[model samples]
Target: KYSQMPRSVGGLNAAGEWYVLRSMIPGLKDKKVLDLGCGFGWHCRYAREQGAQFVVGVDISARMLERARATTHDTAIEYRQQAIEDIDFADGSFDVVISSLALHYVAAYEVVCRKVFRCLAAGGTFVLSVEHPVFTALAAQDWYYDEQGQRLHWPVDNYQQETLRQTRFLDTDVVKYHRTVATLLNTLMDAGFRITTIAEPQPTAEVIAAYPEMKDETRRPIFLLVAAVKPV
Candidate 1:
């Protein structure tokens, strides 16, 4: 099941990609953009669709890069396989840099964040979307089928100050670095990006209405959207 999860999830075209694309706040017209950690170029295509003049996407997964390249044939889009910890980029190279649902995978997230700081031109934007710390907090707890349908059998009780753990998906496991809101904000500030805006997106009202399982007793953030700027 873990092996299938990667494929079934569309190899990085996951739902977080959807939210990232939506949170990007248009302004991409003719911009020099970088899609960091672009798996399978799913969100890369969305960036192009939004009107980036030059979009360079970097990912470490070669298999995924091949698929992304094939799907996106535009000359404006370039996909490369590269590690995020150390990127192949010059100083002040991009007008906008974005990463979707990929930052937390690397333990040395600060290194990449600094690399992003170096890569952005002055006044450029850095937009990122991460799985909410809350989502990571509730992972692998317990789910049960009630009389009606599937629901949680236990309470969600792990939001205890940004602990990191290796989460397993039935078969395969990956480490998830849970960061507190404070931790993230401090990291960006130290990395030289000033926070401009922040958002925690909720599931569509339709989803909550149709499925009782989707309803939240209290507010739980499942996604986070952040926009920061490199000072001129």
Candidate 2:
């Protein structure tokens, strides 16, 4: 789905949202970083370029790790095949952790949150993004369309219902867990993380002008970004 998007520090995505997520990342110099659901290791390579001491990229897909390893030549970076829900690291092993569009796939987000807290160093930051609950709560993730095939409204139902949703993307049906905003925020707090920032990013005017089809992005947020820190 992201094949033609612009390359930023994190990776490419529709609407250039990666740039927004990248902006929330703290300095990487001398930091040890871990990326859960690392996909193609784009963020791992970016961290190495920013002078990270070491970086580990973990993904459930062997195919993704294969491509990541093939494209990455830096000795400071390592790729591992691991599911996000089963991620394990020694206490204080990493200075930062990041996940993009990955957490929604896991059923036990609270468990993963606790693990991330344990793995991070004191004052370490965890930055992540996921499909907005509003977007996922809708049936089939579909938008109301007029006879002319124009989008009329973005329907949001089951706002309070947290459950598994099946949606088709990239010619495949994928399962995603839908959780309310309260659940997401409270999960971090329950895991002892200090909430720092939350964002519902929209395409910038420049981006919309370049890709007119992306203008609808401004109508509703597709993704939500969250940043939290472990207390020192």
Candidate 3:
């Protein structure tokens, strides 16, 4: 169900993430790229189409990797079954690193940031999208609903308290780590990446018109997109 979400069509991803995240990306011509949590190899394939020299997609789920490999037919693209936290590549290994909606699941985002910083070549770009802190701060991971099942307002609580949050998604219990916007930005800066851009994406009027359910997204940010660069 997660993969089946309306993504990559007309440059929109779930919660309108890719709509903004895609614009944050730098050029990929002849660049070596790494995609963390590359479910179904969407970004990997995109990188190759953009003339990337090589692309490596890493995801912990074997099933995800299998699906990615099946859909990918390029020799220059490789899919690896590995957790983002455990990824170890030589220093200056990639010209670009991208992660979509993945970092919230990582308990040690700082560690992964450091790792990404180390692997990225100087002047390389790092772009990522994760569940917004506001959306994950509360255990419910949802909005306040009226008795008639109408969403009133998005609830946010204990935003400063960073910890693991257990929530339901796709009918499965999922654990995600919550960090404030400051913490998320600081973690990347602390890893030696220069803060370039940050976005709390909201749906376009056209998107809201297409999907009326997304109208409530204006009340709160559902995803956070960050772009940073390793200095040359």
Worst 10 residues of 1 by lDDT: 7-16
Q: Candidate 3's C-alpha lDDT? A: 0.89
Q: Of the candidates numbered 1 and 3, which has the greater TM-score value?
A: 3
Residue range 1-232, candidate 1, lDDT tens digits: 5225432344433342344346555488888899888887766777788788889999988987887887788998988888878686999989999887788777777888898999999999888888777666655634445888755444455676466667875666777777777777789999999898887766455544544454562355666778889999
* Per-residue C-alpha lDDT of model 3 across residues 101-122, encoded as one tens digit per residue: 9899998799999999999999
Q: Which candidate number maximizes lDDT?
A: 3
Candidate 1 CA-lDDT value:
0.74
* Preferred candidate (lDDT higher): 2 or 3: 3
| Candidate 2: segments with Cα more than 4 A from true spot | 1-10, 13-15
Writing each residue's lDDT as its tens digit, candidate 2 over 59-86 gives 9989888878988999899999988889
**Candidate 2 local Cα displacement, residue 25, angstroms:** 0.8
TM-score of 3: 0.95
Which regions of candidate 3 fall more than 4 Å away from where they truly are? 8-15
Query: What TM-score quantifies how close candidate 2 is to the native fold?
Result: 0.94
Q: Which should have the higher TM-score, number 1 or number 2?
A: 2
In model 3, residue pairs whose N, Cα or C atoms come closer than 3 Å (at least 3 residues apart or on different chains), thus clashing, are none
